[model samples]
Target: MKYLVMVQGTQADYEAMRGKASPGSPAWSEQEVQAMYAYMSAINDDLSETGEMIDGQGLAEPAHTRTVTLGDDGKAVITDGPYSETKELMAGYWLLECESLERVTEIADRITRCPQPEGAPNYPVVIRPVMEGAGDI
Candidate 1:
């Protein structure tokens, strides 16, 4: 089975990663950021070598995102505004082909152990199975 493994974060978390201090949040130092990169890179390298990882990428900050909604006239309405500071958003994801849901869940568990500044909030790593075809339904 293939899975979309996602990691979530709030705006406060993003700011902390960028070395900006948010009240009650610890800012990540340069070395801390580098360490995080190295840790995640090691995991990616292992997954790639194991033929499990299909693709992965980090998303831009939530502030740079736009929301689109259907208007009454059926037109696409685009809007960008402040989101709740505590609202968690998808920060990144890994597309993996695994033997089973358990295997993918294990991989996601490993990601939850990624290094972080001491006071950083922990969010759940979500895993969703990808349907191979209509037959999967």
Candidate 2:
């Protein structure tokens, strides 16, 4: 099964993360950051060892996004973004090809437990299994 692990959040929640959540910050409490890093690293290592990890990446802030839309003339319209609704923003994602849905769920649980950088508290990671030719399953 293939899965897309989405990191979703609100604009306000993200602004608060700009500090501790920013790249190369020592702002995260040492213990908390260490624990989460260890957990994430372990998850990655385990998945790689099992040949379940296909590809993955951490994203830059949503503020860097650009939107492309079709205009009446059929030309592409480009614009700066926070994208669609600022109330719900997609931060980042992971693509995994696993053996079973159960395994995917296990990975999702670990990701969801990742410590949010200070102000972004209790943020949840959502998992969606990809449907190939079908619309929805």
Candidate 3:
């Protein structure tokens, strides 16, 4: 079955990785950011070679997002993102075909161990099954 494995972060986390730190976020050096990229890349490479990775991507910051919603008059209204500064959002995701929940969970576990600055917050990884066939939930 296919599963979506995701990692979440706040805007502060994104800014911190880019060398800007807010009140609750820690700043990361260029070397620190590069190390994180290297670690995530290695995982992607390994999964691809194993034929488990179907798709993967990193998302842009929430500030770049746009929202579409139904207006009171029923027309579509567009606006900037609704996320607050500290709102947690998906930072990245991997679509994987795994034999079982255990397998996907294992992959997510590996992702959670990716390199970070010593004091950086460790956010949990999320996994959800994709409903592809009848009766899937």
User: In candidate 2, what are the lDDT values of residues 8-31, reduced to their tens digit?
Assistant: 655444454433443333344556
Ranking by lDDT: 3, 1, 2
4-118, model 3: which lDDT tens digit per residue? 9999988888889999988777899999999999999999999999999999999998777787999999999998863765478888999999999999999999999998887
The C-alpha stretches of model 3 lying farther than 4 A from their native spots are none
Consecutive 10-residue window with the lowest summed lDDT within model 3: 79-88
lDDT of candidate 3?
0.91
After TM-score superposition, the amount by which residue 110's alpha carbon in candidate 1 deviates from its true location, in angstroms, is 0.7
Best by lDDT: 3
Write down the TM-score of every candidate: 0.93, 0.71, 0.94
Residue 61 local lDDT, model 2:
64
lDDT accuracy of residue 132 in candidate 3: 97
Q: Which runs of model 2 end up more than 4 angstroms from their true locations? A: 10-15, 20-38, 83-85, 117-119, 133-137
lDDT of 1 by residue, 1-137 (tens): 88999998877787898899887669999998999899899999999999999999988878888999999999999978447743888989999999999899889889999999898888899999999999988
lDDT of 2 at 36: 62
